[model samples]
Target: MTHPALIPGIGVEDTPRVFSTNWAVFGIAGVLVLGVVVWGFLAPDSISAAGAASLGWVTDNFGWLFSLLAIATIGFMFVVGYGRTGGIRLGADDESPEFSTVSWIAMLFSAGMGIGLLFWGPAEPLAYFTDVPPGFTAEPGSRDAMLDALAQSILHWGPMAWAFYALVGGAIAYAAYRRGRAPLISAIFRPIFGERTEGWIGAVIDVFAIIVTLFGTGVTLGMGTLQIASGVEVVTGIGPLGNAGLIVIITILTAAFVVSAVSGIKRGIRALSNINMVIAAVIGVFIFIAGPTLFLLNMIPASVSAFFGELWTMLLRNPAQGNDAAAFMASWTNYYWAWWISWTPFVGMFIAKISRGRTLREFVTVVIVVPSIVCIVWFGIMGGTTMLFESQGSGIADAGSPEAILFAVFGALPFGVVLSVLAMISIILFFVTSADSAAIVMGSMSQRGKPEPSTWVTITWGVLLGAAALALLLAGG
Candidate 1:
């Protein structure tokens, strides 16, 4: 294997330059956010409409492509995992006790489940309940409908999905730490191409990974911003802010997170993730107590049965011609799968960073099973409540917007304001955790394996991501 060219000031032994670069990039993005917020206040509808349009186009046209990429990526991970037994190592000193079994599992759950469980838990199941997609047929609001929704949601977030993230991570981690290679995409093909792989092939993979990471992370960031803004609108009746608002929020948030990431993993990312998990657990408990206990209890068995029955079919189902089936795939299955792949680089790097001491089986099982269980329970709690309320004639179903469903359900519950505040806090922390981790990974990749890259490079990616999200929001609007 060819050794990486060591930059004098930025070697494995040096303090990570990526962290510093991330700080500077964040500062710039902050200023841009302020400007966009001002624009949003002046012209909300136009900006929001643009963002919506862009998002629609992407989802409609490229949804299938994202699904295919995810499948391929997942397939690669399985192959690698089967071929190797030891855990994939990352970084210079293998002795670094970065990956504790508890932390490894905690970080994975936090990073992978951010806002997905919180936002989609209720909404997705409800959507599926109303109209059972492929692999099931049931009337909306019926017992069968609720079960179908939970089952489908679990399948979407299950072992298969988590496996994709673990696969990409395992591949990259093995190459970077085990083989003493630079943590770059080109390293993946080194086994096939020999030392010659570093020149063009490596460069292409690095660039491709960067592009995919940005788009994937951008979507998640955008959704996070939207959820927060929507919550704000609900509480204050300030009206919905448009795409410009989303850009401003995302930019500002990105800057803050980049600064946190630059501060290094132990002090920044870890702390944020820890807090995020606590908040999520609290929210889960709150929903369990506030929502219908009997309904949730009944839904689990039904969901489990429906899930197993449809698992294989859902995995292999590809609707080639029908609009309804295509819509189902694009909106739910395809979107979820793509989102998982898009998160691979960020989540993979984060997983690798924290997975230094774990065994392969430990890493795989935690990555795939733990998060899947969390997702399942989360959906059952939140989504179950929404279905219960709707079935009982609470009028939440009339709200119509999937994005608005969480807020609507929360609004109807007792102590709505307090719950909303709690929800908002959790939402903010979730995205912060995601943004901080993504910035760190992107910084590391850009700097070519220097755990922390230059502060400027880190911030540059942060601002660029914020800008791209803004552009997407405008296009979507």
Candidate 2:
């Protein structure tokens, strides 16, 4: 029955009021902007150079280590589910009308999917189709090519990937709800160290998780925002907004997300999630029915078969020769694993918060299966359509990147202008939801299990993320 520590002199209920102070939030925002400006002027080259160096180090030394660690973490969840006391149960007794099955599903999908689906769905399949990774290949635009693309994308977003998040989420949820512990990464070590996780060790873990999450999720937010900006450029035929446009977009979006987050999970996160899901479904349906429907239908079975046939080999394959396979592994697989790991802290925490009332089995199924399925379908429809179009020799070149593929696919559709507009809007909302969720997680981390961090802390993280993204963008330049 331990409750969140209250601010001195403030009633427990009044904590939210203190936490929501506009002045503090704005001040933090100012610091964030100032940091970004300083970085822009003084260390522009260092930003991208550092990112490249860091990425190189991870790929060269720690790529396999991350994969193995991720696998081990997943294994731990099954042990916990089977051996732990009380097994897994649904819903907390204290909360009013805990997240319903539907709401839970929506929140998970929105938070997990982000804008990656919109950007990667079409391009990744096409990448696999053309180059094919080390373990699998098919003639460009051939039936096999299309299937291979879908299969690989699914494999990337499949059980193992979702399991990574589920393990972390399960660990956090178990510690917080089952053990009456705080929601922090240190809780994962409680089984090993007991109360020793409470002092400096816990603080270090919390801080590490916060910093990693900030950078990782910030990279994602930047990527999503860039996509939105690109989508805007595509639809409106506007000149590049350069770095200034990126800052403006981030500022406006951050404000919207903060408000949604402050409104609490029910009214804000839930509502926005449902709306985003509906929009996503509508977009998927449009692609399925209007784009190469028959081709897409045929591709699924073939892809599933190919994926199964190559699953093990693909997972284990690491090309020693410096060729397409190596590039694919480095660019796609390695980068994705890092991104997922980076995202675990924020997404895992958010998932744990909403997953309070579910069994271990239910949590695993929903968190891993539902979102993975959504990713597969999304890639199938969008990616499948891109292959169909490219095969027909429609003068549509392979979109060098995932972001490019989204614009290409949407541009080819009937009422292309309208659909692209709506898609852009949806991307903005999706980015906000993601940024807000990360902000909340970072806020919680800063406060060390305080349900919500001070407004200043939340805003500070938001601005820093935005600044980091700007640095990455400048580094690319």
Candidate 1: residue 16 Cα off by (Å): 16
Whose lDDT is greatest here? Answer: 2
Model 2 residue 400 CA deviation (Å) reads: 4.1
Q: If scored against the real structure, what TM-score would every candidate get?
A: 0.83, 0.87
Taken over the whole model, the C-alpha lDDT of each candidate is 0.70, 0.71
Residue-wise C-alpha lDDT for candidate 2, range 1-477, written one tens digit per residue: 533221111212322322232333234434554655467558877766766787887787876776676567656655655454223453343333278888888888677766777767777887777766676556666777677778878877766677778888877876676556677887789878878776667666776677677677666777777787777788879987777888788778877887876766778888988888888888889878878788778776677677788777667766474566666777778777788888888888989888876776677667876776677767778878887887777534554546666887777888777778878877877887887787777777666566666776666666666666666565563
Please name the candidate that would achieve the greatest TM-score relative to the true structure: 2
lDDT of 1 by residue, 352-425 (tens): 77775455556666777677777777888888898888888888867676667888998878888777788888
Please report, as a residue range, the 10-residue window in candidate 1 with the lowest summed lDDT. 4-13
